[model samples]
Target: MIKKAVIGVLCAGIALGIGIVIGHFGISSGPSWLKDVAKDVDESFIERFMAEVNTIQIQENLRELTDVPHMATTAGDEKTVQTMLRRWLDDDDGLDDAWREEYNVYLSFPDANNPNKVTVVDAANVVKHSIREKEKPYTDDQRDPDVVQPYAAYSPAGHVKGKLVYANQGKPSDYEELSKKVNLTGTIAITRYGGAGRGAKAINAAPYGVAGVLVYTDPQDINDGFMSDTNETYPHSWYLPPSGVERGSFNRDFGDLLTPYLAAKEETYRIPPENIVGIPPIPIQPIGFEDAYVLICALDGDAAPFAWQGAFNCTYNLGGPGFKPTSAFSNSDVKMDIYNQEVIKNSANVMGIIRGSVEPDRYVIYGNHRDSWVHGAIDPSSGTSVMLEITRVLGRMVKQGIWRPRRSIIFGSWGAEEFGLIGSAEYTEVISCSSFSLTLHGCSYTLEKQMFRLNKTY
Candidate 1:
């Protein structure tokens, strides 16, 4: 009885002590913030953050970034790279650390001197009609010498002339259906965008013996039948202009095209040129729907399947080997003179870090690309503008000794994203992936790789 009474008294005393401590420190919950903590930070933090974000700064950044065409590995891309480095490495307000990592990666570009041409030509080599190499000079943006002509990146440079055929979407199934009706051999396929990937449009045609491919963005798909009316397009509304040519990478693979499984570096194992696959075997080019309409209306054959019909008012047809007898271009063959060349160039990824106050080793990656098909104002420069603005505000806070993140924040201004996501791919291959806790991207480029990770082929 004495032992029990003494034990109960001691337990009561211990409980009372714990209660006093709880009252004094308010220490009931999960583990505390595991560092030299800021005081009562939650109350005003969000308000302060919102106030710090400046719209003018973001706009200025956007304008500067979109001033030129910064295709991956080009001079404009280097300018953007330097811009990122300068912003991130500012002494007064900057990241805790900043650096650039470079990799030599393979890329393809159309010749600036001899532009790729898609034209209607007679057997006598007289040109009946030619699609313009570029969009109508809507503004100085289109006329700039740096403006890359509309050509499928990674398409082989060559000249191929064949009878024109209307192949809808260019999917394997689409081709399979078309093959049942006519021979696809030695045909120049004119396919509209929207069913399969840009590369698959040409890659799917190779098995059926297609000679060349011309891809176009249709009015129904992109403009909602807004052709012949200037009032319904850009500057007037959100519709695409009739001359809008959607250029894109025509490759089924991502990462460095040269180094598949390895990090692209000064010295890495590059697959032999002959070994590369998942790209167009024949030359491919992109044209505006205006050009598409001209070529498509000329074709004469069985009326195209109802499923194959697009927004164009004319009765669509599979080719009867050439143009209709009524058409001015009746005997003219469609020729693609493409001069795309593959080059190995250096691309750099600009990286910045904010060391975590608590767990410096762990990271939360925030990234945006710096390269684009054109100026990329919407796709990346806008996203880049926001990214830079975030870093500026956060960096200012860190510099002023006001706040620090719990997990290290790494900002990536990725390069060569326009060319198969080479920069980020090499970064992942070189870095320790186990250290990454999360990654936030402004655009999605990791879809196929993710698909492959799950054992599903892209």
Candidate 2:
């Protein structure tokens, strides 16, 4: 009986040894074997694709795209679109397809023919300040003479002169207070940027019968460092310097002004002129605070409400026709004269598509406005660089057979966003228009989720 038991134990030990050897050698068969094979393929492709995204590429792309100013509707803007197209074509990630979608849309632009002028004069009619906000230097390569001046896009074209009235921020409530203090009719409104949209300031003043508007960046609104004499500017800190003027659109009504619910195409019907809530009739100009101070210091009336006071050394006041003299304008009239020329032209929108494997009808859209007020390094170029980089990575994954997204991805390089979202709004209008909807099968799109997908592990 003992001999038989010992043999049994030896057989059990041999079986365990064989099992260990098989497992170590990966000799297992069936579904587990297939899973191991699949996992190895995924790991190799994942690492390779991730390695494709790097700082060197990102830096190179940013510098290349931002090397020139590409404001919407300019020759530079078209060139920028072509450059982006070239990059997409040059990509080696084995994309399924690439192309551009062109739309003929109306864009508002400023040129030599259609221009704006803002002049500050004394009672003598001598020009005290004649400089309107022009494109100034931010970097060695950013200055472009053809770049549009600091006029509010879509502002009415007219020449009007009136007494300079210091209206704090030119918001609705500020005007409400001014109406209580003095008559606001026919006076030019002087306001600093803040408290409201720049366009809203102009719109609010129209009801008060103001002749024109002046928008500026007050030192009080800027940071302590920007207002200080000693501080680093751009390429060092993000703080805005004194000379820097913030440029933006003030199209009051929602969506595209030219083509609201319908696309801005020759074939589409447009709303009547009276029905159209388009450009404000008042002439509006945006100036740097340096120019603004020359006028703000000349203001005189009752002491401005405590909240109305700015960082300026002089006390803020609501100046109008009857105000008493306190400064340079004490003995003379402070007047503002403005002229604006509004032009309309055709602009384009560039788009790229990556079809999905499962749900091609649905989409994951990524967009960045490629147009800029200047070089747009911070506004849109930075975001454009990121979008391009993402395309490369996803392309690699698709080529390596590692990822197959459930929804299609569409990359849009929008134009004219700085001009009150013209490019995007027009695009939306085309999508919903009866004639245009036939192509998209009446597809409905929504901004379901938004994410800032960039951050360093460090």
Candidate 3:
């Protein structure tokens, strides 16, 4: 009986060894003799593809894309356009197809020769103090000539001066509270940045009789009041330096400002400049916190309510509508001189496609703006880098016929996005106006973060 049991155990052990060998081979080679037993995970191609995608390629894409500051319509932007085209059109590892779309979009720029500025002028109209037109240049990136001085884009170019009022965030409620305390008319509200859209900062102030707006980043709000000095900020730590002003489009809507309903083709009908709305009617500019500290400290009036106060050392005040008696800016008014201009320029949208094997007409579009306010290392370039890597991996695979998506994949590098989604918006108008134009007067596209995707069924 003992000898019979030993023979049965030996036979069972040999069967187990054979099963293990077949399982290993099935996993390695995919759909092998043991496929039925392994349930056919079909993970071989997926494993190979994921292995090919690595950090080094992603970093390389970032390094190449951000080599220069590529604001829309600038020469630097053209370079980036070429880079995308070259990559997508490469013979060996390129997409199935790639092309460029051009649109004549309206854009804004600060006068390069005559920079925008905020100043304190004496009652006699003599300039007493002027905030620095540009941030303190610490590195080559900051000092780059292409780094445009911080200014409110699309703010009508004009010079206006009035009493300085600390209107927190320049929201409508803020203006209402300040107006109840003191007259807000003919004042240049030095609003700290937050709680409102950049353009709304000025637009909300307009009805309260605020003539102009000077927006700035408060260290408390932006940096959590960790540190205000240059040493404690960027290049040293994560905080923004005192001179780092947040620059952005001050316009209210998306798409080409000139061609609202139509595609921004060269021959598209454009609305007259005077017909435009949703922009600050008054001149506006953004200043650094260092300059804001100087302006706010000079304000003399009743202390603001606790909620309106920020992390500044001094008590936030409803301006005496001017300056403190003890301040050097006494009897002086704040001045905002903005020399911004608007013009129609050609912006490029680089579009690439990977045709699907099953549903060729259906599409999944992945895109990021290629333009920046400055180097825009964070705003858009970071997303652009990740997108480039994705295309590289998928493009190579498609080129070699390793795998194909079920639906078409469209990669778009949009332009003039910093100016308010001009590239993507105009493209939408061209594609969707036939259907959405009659039902919806306007189509709004909001980018959730630096990147967004759309699945187009039609």
CA shift at 396, candidate 2, in angstroms?
2.7
For 218-258, candidate 1 gives per-residue lDDT tens digits of 88887878876467877577677777789888888888888
Error in Å for residue 222 of model 3:
1.7
Q: Which candidate should be chosen as best, given TM-score against the real structure?
A: 1
lDDT by residue (328-414, candidate 2, tens digit) is 445444343444444446667776667666456666667777888877776777777777787777876776677765556766777
Model 3, span 410-435: residue lDDT tens: 78889999899888887777854232
CA lDDT of each candidate?
A: 0.83, 0.67, 0.83
TM-score per candidate, chains pooled: 0.87, 0.80, 0.85
Q: Kindly indicate the candidate among 2 and 3 with the higher TM-score.
A: 3
Cα-based lDDT at residue 209, candidate 3: 89
Ranking by TM-score: 1, 3, 2
Candidate 1 deviant stretches above 4 angstroms: 1-43, 432-458
> Lowest-lDDT window of 10 residues in candidate 2?
442-451
Question: Model 2 residue 153 lDDT?
Answer: 72
Q: How far is candidate 1 from the true structure (C-alpha RMSD, Å)?
A: 6.1
